[model samples]
Target: MRTVAYYKGCLASLSAKELDISTQALAPKVGLELIELEAVTCCGAGDIHEAEPDYYLHLNARILAYAEETGADTLMTVCNVCTLNLRQANHALQGDPALLERVNRNLTKVGVPAYSGGVEVMHFLWLVAAGEGYELLKGAAHRGLKGLKIAPFYGCQILRPSKLLGFEDPDRPSSLERIIEACGGEAIDYPAKIKCCGFPIIQAREETALAELIQPIEQAKEAGADAMVTPCPLCHLSLDAWQSKLKAQTGKDFQLPILHLSQLVGVAAGLADSELKFKRHVVSVAPVTDKLAV
Candidate 1:
């Protein structure tokens, strides 16, 4: 089995617990043995990076250090922001020797190992869309999605600032669509698939956030997507949880079911809905499940 250090960011550990559950459950089925970084703290969700850049590097470097301790060359994350933060840190530390030494000195004081910038930061979606993981996904899909129409949502953090997270073409990403097709689902093409879900600015601008959140769902609905799937828990929160608020503000009900990437893969792999934690979602996934049944 391919071994990697799994890092579930703050949102996945808390509000998006189902994302964590489904990811862990789906890993072994795809020939992956996840060594979860249990002691790792949050990647600061970009807030720390913007306000306190040095502390943000330390936090993410600490996470990388923990991953190094696991003896895994790869550190896999389910959240886009976490992936970005960790990658940004990795890039910074690897390129600047003096900065690495300084961070190492601070880490040493806390009894944590100094990170050598050896671990490669990767997103789970990238794992499944290419290489052996893609083959494993194809093999595990016993009961494929047959006729389900899934819109691929590549949230901002996972794709943008391509110099750092350059796994796929940020402008025209096809990883989600590739996975959907692999599982026998119809991949719907829509403009809002690559747009921001507005989670980052939700607290600062509720109205703007809701507007950003609704656009993709509305576009997906217009494009005939039965459901939407995303790799980022923050994006999932904006698309799924804040949907009600969007309805409240607009007086329009766009009941688009949002699935975590892992959950969608689990469904295609014939995993029981309960195992995927379908009940935990704010929006009912009944529409998607019902269609899958038919």
Candidate 2:
């Protein structure tokens, strides 16, 4: 088994720490070792990409530099946003030597060292499915989710309008649902599977964010999605954040649980309740947990 360094980005290491815990827990069953970074920093996620582009590239690139220092070629991450940002930085560095030089200069200013485009960055899901083959998926899966009407929702960054991490097709993505069914999950047809959850405007425009969120939830509900599964942490916050507010404003009634791909995969892994930290979620997974216990 090769040692795979996990670049548990700033958000996951700090606020969304469960994401780190969840994905690390997942790797062992898949015959992979998720080596933790000795020193990690923010990928300069969303805002940096637009505002401070040069510093952003160097910071994320330093992570790649760290991985290369270990002689490891693959860097895995759980955050879709971080993965995108870092991948964007790496891709830019490889193509434009001028931009790479500038970013390296900025990196030195931050004391993160130089980034030389030495490592490949990946999302943990993509990494697992590739490393383990579908068989480990078969082995880890124990839950009979055969009857579950799941909407395999891919948030904007993960699947995308195209470009970043071309591990799988962007427009007609099936990787998530493919793994879902392999683990005995039943896939549902939801219209808004590719729609953005309006995560970009959340801080600036809260009401718009909620309104944007309603679209996916409504579409999933309309298509009879028993639960919505996503790989993006920001997307989780959007869909699950203002549940009551959405209900009150739209007068739409339903209790839908937004699950991280790790959470859903954990269930398929047949993880014991003791192993899965189901309580860390701001959104309740009780309805699903109740069924699991019975």
Candidate 3:
């Protein structure tokens, strides 16, 4: 089995435990031995934008530092916020020695050694696609997710700064879309496919954020998508966790099912319903799955 360090990003471990558990479960199923890094902190998602920006950079760099210390070439993450923060930090550390030095100083003060940007950051979806290879998953599928109108939400973080992705396309990503198709799910090309989920300004610019995210969600809904599928947990939190708030803000009745890429893979692989943890989501997948089943 291939070994990889699992970085559960702050939101995944705390705010979104369901996705975290699903990620951990999916690993062994796909022939991966997941070693989780201890004392893992937030990937500087919203916190990076607040109080001290430099500290956020160091904190994020520190996580990458920990992953490198384990000698793991690839670090798997589930949160879009965490993936974005870690990848951006890795790029900064690799390009600028001075910046890496300053962040290292912060890391040393905290007893967490500095990182030199060697470890690669990958979302769990990418790990399944590349680490185990798409062929492995396709061979393991017990039942296809037939007739499911799966909306592929790439958001922005995973597909930017092409150098960071190594081989994956940074802008027009097919990583998640391809996975859906491999498992016999219909990957729909909705208009807001690559739009940002307005996650950056959730607290201060909530109204604007809601408008940004809601537009894409509304588009998916109008497009007749059965559910919104994504690899990022914060996109899950913002789009799924805050759906009620989004509904109140928009003053209309709307609900769209959001499933992490891992959960959808579980569905195609014939993993049990409880293992996928549809109940953990703030937005219910019961209606969506029931409809899909019929």
Candidate 4:
């Protein structure tokens, strides 16, 4: 078993609980022994990165401190924002001695071990698809998602800043598509596959965010997608939860069922709907599950 520290961010711990559940269910099948980091706090997602830059250093370093104590060689999270926050912080502390000293100074006062740049941080999707390899997952596909047409949604943060994350070609990432194909599903190619999910500005620019969110849904529908899958919890929220609201706003009813990549993997791995918490979703996933009989 490949041991690693699992960081469940604010969204995964609360709103997107199913992402956490499905991830835990699918980990063992992928040969990952996830070590939960309890003491780790928020990664200062969203506005905090701009409003309070030092807070990310202080909090993320402390989170890494816990991961270091666990002796796990890797630290992983499912949320794209969390992954970006932690990964950027890890890179920053590793490169700049001044920032590391300042962060360590904060850690010492809290009785937490200072981060020594020991653990490598990765998004769960990258860790599984790139690190574990798509073939390993394909070999484990027992109940597989054959005959299902799926569109892969690559949200912004995890892929961008390619030099930092180093997971895939940001312009043309096929890891998610490959993983879907490995799970025995048909991965559809669409124009908006690489488009933004419009999650970040949802609160500030609601109308603009709605337009951005609906663009992918309509494109996926046009491409004959049975469902859309994403690795980011923020994208999941925008694509799954706000889907109908976007319909109401645009007067075009594109009821595209959105799912987390982990949930899709769980189903292909033979996990039941209850195990994946399908009922927790705002938009009914029946459109997606009904086609599962295919």
lDDT of each: 0.91, 0.75, 0.78, 0.85
Per TM-score, the best of the predicted structures is 1
In terms of lDDT, the poorest run of 10 residues in model 1 is: 285-294
lDDT of 3 by residue, 1-294 (tens): 777778887776677787877777777777777889986777767476477777777777878888888878888787766777788778888889989888888888879977877888877777667645577788766577876888899877777556665447665677888888887888888768778898878889988888888877888888888888988877888889778987787676567889888888877787776678888888878765785562
Q: Using lDDT, rank the candidates from best to worst.
A: 1, 4, 3, 2
Residue lDDT tens for model 4, 1-294: 789999989988999999989988888888788999988788888577788987867888999989998999899889888988888889999999998998898899989997788999977787668655355677666788866899999988888778877788899999898888888899999878878888999989988998888888898999999888999999999998888887677788777778898898888888766678988988777876776752
Give per-residue lDDT, candidate 1, residue 169: 90
Taking the tens digit of each residue's C-alpha lDDT, what string does model 1 give over 15-123? 9889988999999988789998888898998999999989999999999999999999999999999999999999999999999999999999999999998999999
Better of 1 and 2 by lDDT: 1
Query: Which stretch of 10 consecutive residues in model 2 shows the poorest summed lDDT?
Result: 127-136
lDDT of 4: 0.85
Q: With candidate 1 superimposed using the best TM-score fit, by how many Å does residue 116's alpha carbon deviate from the native?
A: 1.1
Residues 57-131, model 2: lDDT tens digits: 666778777776676777877877878887887788878999878777876787766767778887877865555
Q: Clashing pairs in model 3?
A: 159-170
What is the RMSD of candidate 1? 1.0
Local distance difference test, candidate 2 = 0.75
Off by over 4 Å in 2: 105-113
**Stretches of candidate 3 above 4 Å error?**
49-51, 98-110, 113-116, 161-167, 291-294
**For each candidate, C-alpha RMSD in Å?**
1.0, 2.1, 2.5, 1.4
